[model samples]
Target: MEDSTHTGALLVVGAGPGVGMAVARRFGGVPVGLIARDEVRLRAMTETLRLEGRTVASAAADASDPTALRAAIGRIIAELGGIDTACFSPLPPVATIKRAAATDAEDLLTALALVVGGAATTVRAVLPGMLARGSGRLLFTTGSGALHPSPERASPAVYTAAQTAYIDVLRRDLSGRGVAVAHVAVVGPVGADGHRPEDVADALHDLADEGGSTVLHLTEGAR
Candidate 1:
């Protein structure tokens, strides 16, 4: 996705260790927004980036909460000027199991609801601003798990389905707009023993190469 245009800022929803911080640091010196629940952790990250001469900002909100997310993104736009890129890494707790038969109803529903519903909330909140500008990057971090469900794992089929559907919605819904929706199709564990966040950030930033329509992938594992 190549573009002659530029964005005012980048907003990251799940500001965690791997991809989240990596993306922030990649654009650290620019006006950026960090949205996550752990204020203490966020403050530490902001402080670190500031010490490194990055003009970073922060907003606290659980992406799973509709009202809180709206307020948080609203504040980010106000502080960061404008969000040209919205990256969602909403790492709400997930129920991973060793066997499919062991999955509980509560765990399955919660996971499915959060991933599907939360993705919807984030997309709805960000796309309007993105479309108005006609040039923006809306990114979501996804893993190999979304592509495939292992029978050995006690994974809820619904969770995987919802995630795939969520990505498809972005791909299909935002085709004509100048906004570019991309997914960091993760292949392995997010942090250690897999592709690093820095690597993923590099991959995502490559979207700058072609800035039209929507982009997504199931990278290494088709799961």
Candidate 2:
């Protein structure tokens, strides 16, 4: 199916290479707003999309900081007119990864702040506009560790599972409200094996355009 075109703005949080960039490109037909912690990288990505003849804007903020993230989202919304679709895929820091035996409370808390907390903050920031307009799409991407526990990746597993549940509840509450929510679980390493970022982007695009299911699992060999 051809990717549906969006007339309103699309916001990509945790915007960077791989999945984030692929999403931005996939939805480049609309005014694209990007949010990431690295100002330099965000500017570069914005410029890259602009060079492609896309209407692009960017803001720098760490998703873990709610104040910063909200401000960034507001700036993007002001610049792009309003966010009609928002995609969030913030990866937890490497230090947060630890085996179950080696994991501590602090590690789990940090992961929660970055993964679940960040997603919630992003949702809160964009939801008002979506609700006011009576239409919007909230898309999220996480690792399959969300569904299958990984002893070696204890922190991620805990927070991603929480995030998955959060998205599920959001979908349940938002049903018949005109706003769509979907989560995509990536089963393997992106850009390796047969799993590509573009394929994931396509799945996300589908979810945003066609809101049938609340969750989708993107494996290495499947779309």
Candidate 3:
């Protein structure tokens, strides 16, 4: 059931399919703002939610571009009034994936720009209002490499590790401030190994509703 006391809108960065859309759907009871690079996909997702009787808005911006991303977030905040929950779950391009030994500096930089840079930009954009309100939820979806680094997936691992560290610091710094920060690390690929997107969304929803400093290592059949 949706909490009657919480009325602020949700802003979803990297609002693509799978986990992104699932998170939006899970929070459908409240007004939602979607952000992604694809304008067409954003329009389609917006319409889908609207058709479901949901209050939703969308913007197209590449997460890796801080200027564009901040602008997109600003537009959504204007449309939705205020954001109480923000989720960051961008999937890096397949071309960026490379093993540690094989990865060049350029490859690592590109991944970092999308993963760490995007998360930081989104947090800076939303954090001030949340701090003033003394309540909000900052949720992040990352891969198992974040917690247990894999040399086979070096680019993603490095960025996610940094992101996880950022979340940990925020958890400590924001403790008792009424805002909650949570990280959900998927131990396996979604849609395979029984790790469904809906389940991930469910976990994120729980974190948003029950404010706390939590790091949930999500695996198949484990909530």
Q: Show where candidate 2 strays beyond 4 Å.
A: 1-5, 212-223
For candidate 2, which ten residues in a row score worst on lDDT? 212-221
Candidate 1: residue pairs that collide = 1-209, 1-210, 1-211, 2-209, 2-210, 2-211, 99-154, 100-154, 147-223, 148-223
lDDT of prediction 2? 0.82
lDDT of 2 by residue, 21-113 (tens): 898888766888999998898888889888988888899999988899989998988888978889998765679888999999998888888
Residue-level lDDT of model 3, residues 75-147, one tens digit each, is 9999988889999998765686778899898988887888888999999999899989988899988876766
Model 1, global lDDT: 0.69
Pick by lDDT: 1 or 2, better one: 2
lDDT by residue for model 1 (10-109), tens: 7888787667888876654467788888889888877877787667889887777878888888887788777787777767455554467777777676
TM-score for all predictions?
0.84, 0.92, 0.91
RMSD of each predicted structure: 4.0, 2.3, 2.1
Q: Could you arrange the candidates by TM-score from highest to lowest?
A: 2, 3, 1
